[model samples]
Target: MLAQYLLGKFRALVRLLIQCVSPRQVKLETATYLRGSKTSELDDEDHNVVEWAFSGAYDGDKPILIDAENPARSLSKNKSLDLVTRLSGSFEPGSTVCLHLQNNILYPILVLAILATGCKWTGTNPACTRSELEDHLRVSRSKYIITSEDHEDMVFDVLCRMDEDIELILFSDVTVERPPSKDGKHPTLHDLLANSTFLPLESRYQRLSARTAATLMASSGTTGLPKMAIRAHGALVCESRSDELQDAHKPYKIRRLFCTPMFHAYSFPKMVINPLRQGQPTYYMQRFDDTFIQKLSLYSITDIITVPPILSRLVDQARGGDAKPLLQSLRTIICAGAPLTVKLRDEFIQLFSNPPQLIQEWGMTECGCISRAGDLDADMPTTVGRPVAGYLVKISQEERVEIPGGGFASELLVKGPQLMDCYLGDDSATASHVTSDGWYKTGDVGYLDARGRIFLVDRAKDIIKVNGWQVSAAELEKTVLQVPGVMDAAALSMGHSLDEHPYICVVRTDHGVSEKEIREVLRSQLSRYKGSRCELQFVDGLPRAASGKLLRRKLKAQLTHREK
Candidate 1:
């Protein structure tokens, strides 16, 4: 493993060096250009060509010119300059092209535009929703979206909803929507691609700097509406951004993990993409199932990124002596989305006995992964670790907010390349939250210790005003989950009455545990007022998206539907 990692790095360093000094305009290493591949046997020409490709071949291994005559032609010297003349021209820095994958066919122009000049391209699936598709659309500000015959409906939906104007064509050709008596929607992605002719990329678009914003992604913000976050082209300057690397501080090969869906900003950036940039394989669960998660080792997985809920299931499975060796094969396991409690942390450490290190990360949609710590695996006090590179963070207390260190527990504000440019076209809402300077108001309640570890308390939106006091729904939910039979809990203020009391409901698990035991557990651990202020209800499970985010609206709807 070490040999493979070192070889990959050595090749990358060589490639970086060649790009700076040599004029490499031709050739690519079809296999070696990727981040971390297991195969080693290759010709000497492939090695040097990979080195040149990394430096200049289509802006770093995008496969523009391909295996041309005499593969080692340097772009600077006359020998390579001739090859460059034969090949495509340079690309703008911020162009992030979207590869609309259809069956196995690769479109020629789509390949040239993306591979020609180091412009980045990311592949997408057809099943993505309009809002889900918009994240990538907004994140990447994608140059062109290539879609097949069937997926144009979703693309049109997003284009209609977007505030920014975007140029559209199809993966197949120019689309012509069959008119309903000349009054119908336009043609589809397939039609557009099939009919479109090659036009020179506008000259103005060719000179963009790499630091310029290329893409954007949206997430469920603390506000009721979705907020867009920017993902700059510069974010991928390094082959392996250290922040997303495995804890060993090594570029580990990312293999398979299916617990998370691709649509989530967290999973898309951290799990799926970070690895793909490094050319590692990622297998998504598509959907999660306990027995399948328990049997993952059969497929030879090396890493996994998950939240507390999934980790809890792993512990539950491990407690019964199942999935032991499978987990033993694991390299790095990351956790976020909620705090990893000391009780649960200790249980994992004791059971795994020096198994995969648990990293508790703290981040939100406003920015990507901010902090992570290994102390979490050892049962250290919970705090989202220090900020990663290319990011700045500050915590300040306003009138309604409070933190332990005077300003320690205030709203966390972040500014970084990964921050979104704006929410589509909602300028008023975007201007209201993002400052003139660039600081985004996170609306998150957290305190940063002197060492920079952040402890999240709750969302400012989820804060419950009770009797002139603020009660954190997170605090209540944490306590409820500790109950022997409780699976999940969510708390929302019913409405502020003159009486000012908390109305909390806990969803208890039916894992053969009784409601009497659950309520008794809460009563024994909580104060009389706190204990008596809540009701216990047995539920199958809390409503969640494929990405494991709670859908509070659905929970509220479920309560209303049941009441009726």
Candidate 2:
């Protein structure tokens, strides 16, 4: 009894010592950097993501993944695991599996099956044009393409043109009762799942280590063509584990409504691993449409992870006063992908009767979610909160010099377990983005506050320099969006690098607001150096990627072509 008491006291003392030694911000040499309050040791674990995800204790018969389009189409834990085990025998080890399908109930299951078989998985947008699809296939060097019947012709054509002997597989919605492939040339996912055999519990399946590449997520090609980012099993496992730890303290259960594309990195891990691990019911929307507001109320969705454009649309709908009651069931709205402006954040929160916490997270395809705003930091509108567990953040100027807190915005650098292994097949590109010392240059210009909160100014490449002043395009775009008649806006630099000018493209409402009025508003709200010489062009709509990031390079190319 005495020994037991002593051991308990020793554990308590160790916990107290750790708390005392933990610092909110660490000083490294002359620069101050921020480290996550929590640290995870799963970075070096030699385990496959599939094994880690399924190891969680959860109800096997619970309907955790449901289709919002057809409520009857749902997957319980047992059903999903069964499908995964059966389909795991289809792929050979170390081959790449590419998915070209829209958001559906079966997508996540396919992702799991691919990873379980010791193969790399990549997904392309279903709506990609023929050439774009070909480019993706060429870059990913995918050995097998899994697509729906709707896209089979396009996929076949692209494969034929490339003269690659890639196998093609067809997928159907979970609700469909697909027949076996008549020709046997291309098998359906259902056909694979119906196979009686399972993967041998022996040496046939290769063991996956932490460093093994599990996913090849395509980066959002905002600047140019998309590159496939290789993510290791350990990285994904670390990311999911971090999120699970963070949510462990929450008081209420999370019932998520996921409308974001499953193919993108922003939503991939969350959709594939989180719901099952947490034993939470997640509704999958094929696409965000007119029925979104009603579905939220019908399902009593407590949480949603979406992009800013969808939130803006929701805020606009809330103006009618009907959406207020429908949205009251929501307890949290986590926005990522593109920047969420202070104006939109505040406006949207105020519209809710019982306002849901609108949290903004900062991250990219190359890295998983870097930071997320907490409930306490919600009032600090512009901040993306502090770094999560296993992340270190710093700022770099011209010579890797760190500026003091609240000083001018510098390029943000992050080191974390969730960082992608490499830009797949592009070693030079990987070296250019990541420094030798292990810091990943985010290419985003932001500053760390004294409190260690991060505030994103703009993408380093998107900062427009006019005269001697550096202006943030995101800030300017935010200001433009506040105008009453403006529905959407994007800011671009229109001149040479040394001498650049701001050009604002806007999509106006039917209210028919004039250009002079927008300029007047900008002139009143912004300084002369920031807004005076701005040029405005009215357009029907702005082009954006599936992740809601503005396609600025594509837009600039279109504008330049028109001028020519």
The lowest-lDDT stretch of 10 consecutive residues in candidate 1 is 30-39
Candidate 2 lDDT (Cα, whole model)? 0.76
Candidate 1 TM-score, true structure as reference: 0.52
Top candidate by TM-score = 2
- Which runs in model 2 stand beyond 4 Å of their true positions? 1-31, 41-44, 173-179, 194-196, 200-206, 220-223, 399-406, 462-564
Error of 1 at 396 (Å): 1.3
lDDT of model 1, residue 77: 24
lDDT for every model? 0.50, 0.76
* Cα lDDT tens digits for candidate 2, 230-267: 98887888888877876676556788898888887778
- Candidate 2 is scored at a TM of 0.75
Kindly list the per-residue Cα lDDT of model 1 for residues 39-105, writing each as its tens digit.
1111112111112222321223222211112213212222222222222232344466675543221
State model 1's lDDT: 0.50
Worst 10 residues of 2 by lDDT: 22-31
